[model samples]
Structure formats: C-alpha cells, structure tokens
Target: MKAALWYGKKDIRVEEIEEPKVIKGNVKIKVKWCGICGSDLHEYLGGPIFIPVGQPHPLTGNVAPVVLGHEFSGEVVEIGEGVTNIKVGDRVTVEPIVACGKCPACKEGKYNLCSLLGFHGLCGSGGGFAEYTVFAEDYVHKIPDSMSYEQAALIEPIAVAIHSIRMANFNTGDTAIVLGSGPIGLATIKCLKAAGASLVIVLQRKSIRQEYAKRAGADHVLDPNEVNIAEEVKKLTGGLGVNTAFETTGAKIGFDIGIDSLKYGGTMVITSIWEGEMNFNPNVLVFSEKKIVGTLAYRHEFPATIAQMSDGRIKSDGYITKKIALDDIVEEGFGTLTGPEKKKHVKILVTPDKSLLSD
Candidate 1:
C-alpha cells in the first residue's frame, strides 16, 4: 500500500508502506477519495501542529512521519472481531477523531474537547491517504447510496460547519457572517443557509472563493479589500450587526473583521485551526458584551450532517475542484492548493485507487 507520510515542514513523501491490519472492534477500508484539508496544508507549511514529534501522541502512540489524510470516504473491505453493526461493502465516511472516553469532555459527550485530543490521521493512529487503512469501527459512519464517494469525502468538513452552528445556538431568522470562503468557510455558508439563517454575509478576499461564497447561499458577499466590512454588515443588519459570526479564516484580519462585525451579545465561532497565536484587545469583547467561542472538530454531528446532505439541505456540488492520484498528492494536490493559483481551487480530492480517476 502506498501512503503519504509527513516528514516535517515542506516535506511529505509518498512511499510504499505496509497495509494496516484490522484490530479488534476495528474495520479496514479501501479508501476511495480523500480531500487534502487546510489543516494538512498547515502542517506541510509550518508544522508539527497536530503531528506528534519526539513524544508520542497519548492516544495513537505513533509520532511524526506518519501517514496523513482524514477527510475521506471509502468502502468497508474487511471487519475485525466484535464489529457487528458494520460489515463488508458498506460505503462510509470516517469521523477520524481519537479521544479518551475517560476525560471530562468525553464524559460530558463533548469528545471533541478530550483533554489529550488528537486526530486519527494527524495524530498517527492510521490515515486515509493510503490504499487501505484501519480504524475503530465506531469512528466510521455509513453514507447513503445516493451520495458519491467524492461528496461523502466532504462530510467531515460539513460536519464541522454544522457543529459550529450548533455551538453558536444560531437562530434561523438571525443574521450571521462567515469570514473566509475556503473549504470550511464554504461549508459554513451552505450549512448556515440550510439552518434557515435570514441573512448570511461573507467576508472574502479577491479569489474564486468569492464566487463560491455566493453559490453557497451567502446573502451578501463583501470583499474585505473593497468595502468596510463592519460598516457594511451594520447596514445589512440595520445597524445592529449580525447575530452570529463564523471565523473560518485563521488570518488576523479575518479575526478582526469577525469581531468587529458582531452585534452586542453576538456570538463568534472560531472554526479554523490557527497556525499561530493572535493578539487582540479583550476590551472589544468586554465593551460589546459579545462572545467568541471556538469549535475544534465534529463530535456527534456526523450522522445528522449526512442526513442533511441526503435530504438536499446541504449539497457538495462544485466544492471539489480537482482530483489526483496519491502519487501526485504533494504537487498536484497540496502544491496546487497553496501555490500562486490557489484561488483557482476550493477542495482537491486525492485517491489511492486509480480506477476512480476515470470519472
């Protein structure tokens, strides 16, 4: 089996590795599609962010140079002992979160906040970037037959958007602003519309993402460079500003715009996995009595998110901009996504199986 391993910053090698075996209560999947995530790009550019180094990850016990790729969907090829509910041939998407059930967050059904929180792909347990990978059966959720593997690969990010909305307790009739129109940002826009938000404003720079923001149902798309985002948001919301703001861009400017675009008592959900620390005035929040909450990853929203997509509330059309074989992941997948022409792409799905490439 060939898998892409993260050596360090700016170094990812796709090498022939031993295929993972099925463990007790686990299942082995033949990966069909895996999207190169923004987080993966983060690690490639300035990492060891989620990739455990000298010290092993408390959960997966594996360290750096491990196989990567988590946002994926595949067919169940084999099952381990005690895995009864899932069986061979089930089409599925994995949640990919590795958590300790004993932690306070886990005990409270908030597993995404597990004290030693880690991810299956990023933390090195097993990843979807290879031809075959194994994981605890519980982390895999079945997808509807109506959905394509390419679309199912999007469930992971879509679940992220849904969870952020739930964290905000966003009201249907309320207005919200999404800062950034990247993969997660685009998903946030679609999820907000599906949640019945009356007004969804988008803050995007000059890129193809601006077009995606509108297609995802943003009521107003504002170029941060061309317009005063805060003032425009105020005017759109009748001087009160939006009821919620989703910070999907980890950039400082996006953070600033999100904070400034909120109304008094408005909630801002930070969904991006930031590359570095941010400096800001606490007085801003104190003055407006506003709230800024952070969302790590999806918890129990996987199933519901699939149902939403199945029912047509959320669609994956137009999200995937490119597809490449695992051999081309570093250049064609990661490079194209972060290079000079990055604006030309939104989501790029990589496949270990070449047969699917014909599509």
Candidate 2:
C-alpha cells in the first residue's frame, strides 16, 4: 500500500508502506477519498504541532512519519473479530479523534477536550491517506447511500462548523459574523444560515473565497482590506454589533476584529488552531461583558452534519476544487493549496489508487 507520511517540516513522502491489519473490535477500510486539511498543511509547513516526533503519542504509541490524512471516507473492506453492527461494504467516515475514556472531559461526554487529546491521523494509528487503514469500529459512522464519498469526506469539517455554531447557541434572527473564508469558514457560513441566523457576515481577503462565502449563504461579505471590518459590522447591525462572531482565521488581526465586532454581551468563538500566541486588550471584554470561547474539533456532531448535507442545507458541489493521486500529494495537493495559487482551491482530495484519478 502507498501512504503519504510526514517525516518533518516540509517533508512529506508518498511511498509504499505496510497496509494496516484488522485488530479485534476494529474494521478495515479501503479509502475512497481523503481531503487535505488545514491542520495537515500546518504540520507540513511549521510543525510537530500534533505529529509526535521524539517520543510516541500516549494513546496510539506512534511517532513521526505517521500516516497523515484525517478527513477521509471509505468502504468497509473487512471487519475484525468482535466488531458488530458494522458490516463489510458499508460506506463510512472515520471520526478520527483519539481520546482517553477515563479523562474527566470524556466521562462528561466532552471527549474533544480529553486531557490526552489527539487525532488518529496526527497522533498515530495509521491514517486515511492510504489505500487501506484500520480503526476501532466505534469511531466510524455509516453514511447513507445518497451521500457521495466526497461529501462523506466533508462530514468531518462540516461537523466542526456545526459544533462551533451549537456552542454559540445563537438564537434565531440573531446576527453573526464569520472571520476568514477558508473551508471551515465557508462551512460556518452555511451552517449559520441553516440555523436561522437572520444576518451572516463573512470577512475574507481572497476573491475566490469571497465568492465562496457568498455561495455558502453569507448575507454580507466584507474584505477587511477594503473597509473597517469592526465598524462595518457595527453599521450592518445598527451600531449594536453582531450577536455572535466566529474567528476561523488564526491571524491576530482576525482575532482582534472578531472581538471588536461584538455587542455588549455577544459571544465570540475562536475556531482556528493557532500556531502562536495572541496579544489583546483585556478591557475589551471587561467593559462589554462579552465572552470569548475556544472550540476544538467536533463532539458528537457527525450524524447531524450528514443529515444537513443530505437535505441540501450544505452544498458540496463547489467545495471540492481538485483531486490528485497519492503520488502527487506533496506537489499537487499540498503545494497547490499552500502556494501562490492557493485562492484558486477550496478542498483537494487525494486517492491512493491511481486508477481513481480523473480530469
């Protein structure tokens, strides 16, 4: 089997690797489609962020050179001993989260915040960037026949958007703003509209993503480079500011704008995985009685996200911009996504089987 493995910063190789075997209570999957995620890009650019290097991950006991694709969907090729309820040929998507059940957060049903939090693809346990991978049966969710493999692959990110919205608890008819027009930002825009937000604003710099933000149902798209974002948002909300704001861009400027574009009691949700620390004035929160909350990945939101996708609340037509073979992952997949032409793409899926690649 051929898998894309992370060696170190700027070093990802797609080479032949041993196929993962089925363990008791686990299921083997033949990967159909795997999307290159922002987190994966971070690892390739400035990491060891989540990829354990010197020592093994506490949960999966794997280290550097780990297989690296978490956003994936596949067909169940084989089922392991003691694995029930999931059958061979079932189309499914892996949740990919690695959490210790004994952790207080896990016991409280907030497994995304587990003290030993990790991801199957990032921490260890061979990931979905290959022809075949295995994971415990409990972590895989069956997708309806109506959903395509590409849409199934999107469930992970859509789940992320849905979870962030759920955390905000934004009321119907409330106004909201989403900072950044990346994949997660686009998903957040769609979810916000679907959840009955009366007004949804998007902040983006790239022309391609600005168009995507509109297509994703944003009521307004503002380019920070063109106007004062916080003031513009305030003007749109009748000078009261938005009821809620989501910061999906890890940039410090986006973070500051999101906080500043809030009502006296508004909530700002931080959804980006930042690479560095941020500096902001505490008086902003202290004076306004505002709240700033940070969210990790999804927590038990996959099923609802799939249902939303099936009902057309979230469209998958334009989200996927390109597809490539496993061998071309580094140059075509990662390079195209992070390079100068990055704005031209939204999501790029890679297949381990060359036969699956097409024009």
Top-scoring candidate (lDDT): 1
Question: What range of 10 consecutive residues in model 2 has the weakest lDDT sum?
Answer: 350-359
User: Any residue pairs clashing in model 1, and if so which?
Assistant: none
Model 2 regions lying over 4 Å from their true place? none
C-alpha TM-scores of all predictions: 0.99, 0.98
Error of 2 at 257 (Å): 0.7
lDDT of 2 by residue, 92-202 (tens): 999999888898999999999999889977997889899999998888999999998988999898899999998998788999999998989988998888889999999
Give the alpha-carbon lDDT of every model: 0.92, 0.91
Query: Per-residue CA lDDT of candidate 1, range 199-297, in tens?
Result: 999999877788899998988899978999999999988899999999998999998999999999999999998888989999999998999998988
